[model samples]
Target: MNWRRLWAVMLKEVRQLRRDRITLAMIIGIPVLQLVLFGYAINLNLRGLDAAIADQAGSAGSRALVMDMLATDVIVPVREARTPQELMALLKRGEISVGIAIPADFERRRIDGRAVAQVLVDGTDTVVQSAALQLAQVPLDTTPSANAGPLRDAGLSAAQRISVVSFYNPERRSAVNIVPGLIGIILTMTMVMFTSVAIVRERERGNMELLIATPLSRSELMVGKVLPYALIGLVQTTLVLLLGIWLFQVPIRGSLLDVYLASILLIVANLTMGLLISTKARSQFQSMQMTFFVFLPSILLSGFMFPFAGMPKIVQWLAELLPLTHFLRLIRGVMLRGAGLFELWPEVLALVVFTVAMMALAILRFRKRLD
Candidate 1:
């Protein structure tokens, strides 16, 4: 080394970086975005989990336990179940994360010094399940001396306990949860990457100029490019579902039709997003880079691997914006919870809005590029 030559080369590179505005912005913006996502949005503290209560005892003791559990703020009762079966159904449907069943003899047992309550938890997400189990124990661990009101009147002692029952992968099998979510993750990765390079490849090959000279409308061109990938996405979804069922033994507890319909919407949403990336990217390499940017957030922030509720409020909001986040919920809700359109309409509607918005933006950007 020549010190002056190294300085001149470094200055030249900096000037080139300044000229490539998009890449420069990405270099600066992506790091900031990742820092914010990791530092502020990601959290493991579980709170405000949806809970269902089945108060068969209907006694003051049972009611006090419920209140104490609610006070913990770990789980909040969203619905009341009249029977144990109803509570289980709620758990199976993913409608509630935790279920409390106060036995009909709960009060009598408490008075007799043998009180026992059952807490049923959805164990699919191990992190949430672990937090929930600890939180559910709070009320049970309350000694008669510690409880001031009806709980003390019930003759409850430290012997009174809440037995936890894990439901949906009771063993906390990661496959049962991950396999279902893998369907969406696989679809997102393939669908977005496959289509992201479509238009940019055309431009790279110099075909874009010829196509633009034709009378084809932007919408027509976009549809023509995206339809093939949409079909490919559906085929990929079917193959993945079969593999998951056969290889992982992941049960499809819900209607296959519901899963297919939601999968289609998810596919279209991602495909449109790819189209939007293609519109912005001037080269195939840039398109792939942009797709990876989208892909990372889809995988990390979508609650596919992490508990959605574990993420902070702002991160949750950002997660909600990703199509994969909603799709994961839809797929898991249908496959594990047997959720119907009524339970899933919100996610479906979100996918619809995302698809339309991405398509509109892609078209607008394409036209601007043409002009």
Candidate 2:
């Protein structure tokens, strides 16, 4: 186990990884390009969802109630129909998420002090259906008398009822909530994938020997190799952020600097972890297989789509170790809650520790394997 031999191998590997275009693209170009496409533009929230209205009563009071439903941020009224049959067809065809019905005797019954209105929602989509149900009944919450029947409108004023507000994802907009999460996932996947490719490429081509023959120390070589990939990660982060602001109108409520700094730190940890995996893999195929193994757990356990609280306690606790979970917290806190440096220090520190540990392990493995 000669120290000089290890230093020589590390230097040559760094040079080869730097010169290879495939490695360069993986480390520098892919992460940025993907971050731009997947993180900034995609949305999961259901907003301004389509809705159909049936007005059998054709009364002024019924019309007013329909307007109130439309006024809420949840539903977008697409068309007015005369029959319930026409509205049902729209729902089956996937043209709308919900429909509202006013009975034929709505006006007459209301004037006579008897009133009833029905709202039909597609149960298939829990998110959209829930939004529709909440907004539709908000009016009812205000005037119990107003909803009792249309004829009774003369005595009750809806103006005095308490206002309802949305939590977590307000404005019922999907892009705002999803962009932050998309950023975290995209960064982790891209950074790890690229770094894995670089390490495996060296093993496949037998050029690692040429690197081991050089004078560069193992630590110096590792730093040099990681720096270029780190730059690429920064580029990707910038593109995603720019696109999110321009295309999706997602606000960066927190310090843009904090988001970038935290993201860079997170990317470094992801790349180092990838490097560690590559150190042990016998071939590129094995490296990729290992990547899938890591990716699935990180994504599912990371709480990108599934709520962390809803999962069993064990699953939630396991997810805490993945970099994605803490990164999501930082991204969402900054993007949605406008959190600052003070709020995000803990996540940044965790990322730093993870990166240092992974890089050290990869370096140690490389030294032992070469000896």
Candidate 3:
């Protein structure tokens, strides 16, 4: 090997790298972005999880119990329900994280010492389950102390007071949570990969001129490109769900129609996103690079692998921009919590907005003339 020749080749490669601005940016940007995300944006310790209180007793004792729990900061109070059933419904709809149900017989129940105030936790998310379980272990000895609070005045003291009920995946099975999310993950990867290269492949194969000669409107062309993959996306959805159910024994407690409705919405959004990326990318490789740029954050910030509540407030805001975040909530709500479409309207609306915005961007950016 000639040492000079090796040096010359290495220098030439470095110069070529500097010339490709996009690649150069990616080389520097990917590492920095990952550092920021993993270092600051992500968190394992949960705080401010949305929660609700069902004070059936509506007494000072109930209020004190709520205040004491709120003081723990394990959860944040969001809604107030009239009954335990209403609180459970809110949980089923994926509206809140913790549900504190203080029974009408709050003081009387503690006399025998089994479960005084029932606390229901949505166990679909193991992170949340672990965090909210702190309430159950809220120092049983404190209840029997001589504190002059009204709650103590009510004589609500017991060895076991808060009966924490883990709803949904009672056993805290990771598969139950992961399976529904896998549907979104699979669709995101395949649909985006399939269509991101569509336009680039056309240009690569010398089909751009043929497409240009056609009289098809940009909207028509964009729709035509995305619709085929939308069907494929649904097909992929069915396959993943079937495998998840059969292999992992993940239960579908909610209506299957609601699951399909979520799948369809997510499918279109992902397809349109790919089309949008396809319009921007000049090559298949670059399109995939961009897809990966979108993909990494989608998985980390989207609450697929980590708890959404665990992210910083700004990170949570950013996660909301990704369609996968909303899709996970929708699919998980229906499959694990037995929730209906109407109950999960916020996610549905977010997906609708993302789909329309992506399709419109793709159509607007798409041009007949070759670059």
Candidate 4:
């Protein structure tokens, strides 16, 4: 290689990169975004988990135990349930992460030195469950009856024990938690990247102008572009699901029909997002940058790689805006917890809203580009 010629080519490429402001910004911005997400938003220390209490004993010992659990600042009881069914219903709806049940004979058992309280944890999220288990154990080390003072003075043995039970992934296998979520992450990445480049490539090659010149309406053109990809998304979803089942031994606890239906909604949402990116991007490189901009948050904030509840409140609010976040919740709920439409309707509604909003934006942006 000629040193002079190589230096000249390198200088030319440097000038080209300097002029491409979007790429330049991405080079600086992507790292900063990653730092912010990883340093500030990503948290492994689980705290302030949503908890529900079913106190059947209604005694001083039971009240003292509840207070002790809350004082740990790990599990925050948000609701009270009258029965076990109500507590389980809360868990199924993803409303609470942990449930505490004090049996009717809890006081009697504690007096006999064999008190047992039940702690039911949602084990779909292994990280959260692990932290909850540790937090739940804190109360067991102390005697709730002794803390009550009255029970201790009554000559009762100050001892309390808790039985911890996990739902969904009873064994706390990471694969069972991760494989179902991988389905959504894979779909989001592929669908967004694929559709983001589609219209931009057409425009880059001078095909979009010809298509626009035809009698075909913009909506028709958009639909035509998206339909095939939507079908492809379905195929991809099926393949991932099968692979997860075969390789990871992940069980599908809910109806396969529910999973398919939810997958379609999620696929459409991501495709619309990609089309929107395509409309805004002037080149394939810009499209790819924008795709990564979206993709990073989808993986990070969507609870695909980290626990959603572990993030701060503002980050959790931001996570709610991501379609993948909602889809992860939906897919995980169906696959792990046997949750149905009734349990997952909120996430389903969020996906529907996301699809409509993205489609509208893409259509508007493309029309303006045409003008």
The Cα error of candidate 4 at residue 300, in Å, is 1.1
Best by lDDT: 3
- Tens-digit lDDT string for candidate 3 (40-147): 988889989999888888766667777878888888988878888899888998889899888887655544454767778999999998998778766543353243
State the displacement of the C-alpha of residue 139, model 3, in Å, after optimal TM-score superposition: 3.3
Best by TM-score: 3
Model 1's alpha-carbon lDDT is: 0.81
Model 2 residue 330 CA deviation in Å:
0.1
TM-score of each: 0.86, 0.57, 0.93, 0.91
Better of 1 and 2 by TM-score: 1
Which is the better candidate, 1 or 4, if ranked by TM-score? 4
Q: Using alpha carbons, what is the TM-score of model 1?
A: 0.86
Which 10 successive residues of model 3 have the least lDDT summed? 150-159
Across residues 1-371, which tens digit of lDDT does each residue of candidate 2 receive? 99999999999999987866445555765566446424532333445667787888776667777777777756778766668787665554435556777788765544554434656664333355456555545453223244554345443323222122233345556677667777777878888887776766875687678777888787877777788888888888888888988998888767888888778878888989888887867667667766766786677666576544334445567777788878877777666556665656677777778888999998887762343
* Candidate 2: segments with Cα more than 4 A from true spot: 1-164, 368-371
Q: How many backbone clashes does candidate 3 have?
A: 0
Better of 3 and 4 by lDDT: 3
Worst 10 residues of 1 by lDDT: 141-150
lDDT of 1 by residue, 1-371 (tens): 99999999999999988987777878987898789777776677888888888888886667888888788888888887999899887876677888888899875556445546777888778887787777445645334433433344344433236677787677787888998888789889988898889888887787878897889998999988888888898898899888988888888878999989888998999999999998888777778788878988888899986678777777788889999998887888888767785677788889999999999998888862443
Instruction: Please give the CA lDDT of all the candidate structures.
Output: 0.81, 0.67, 0.86, 0.84
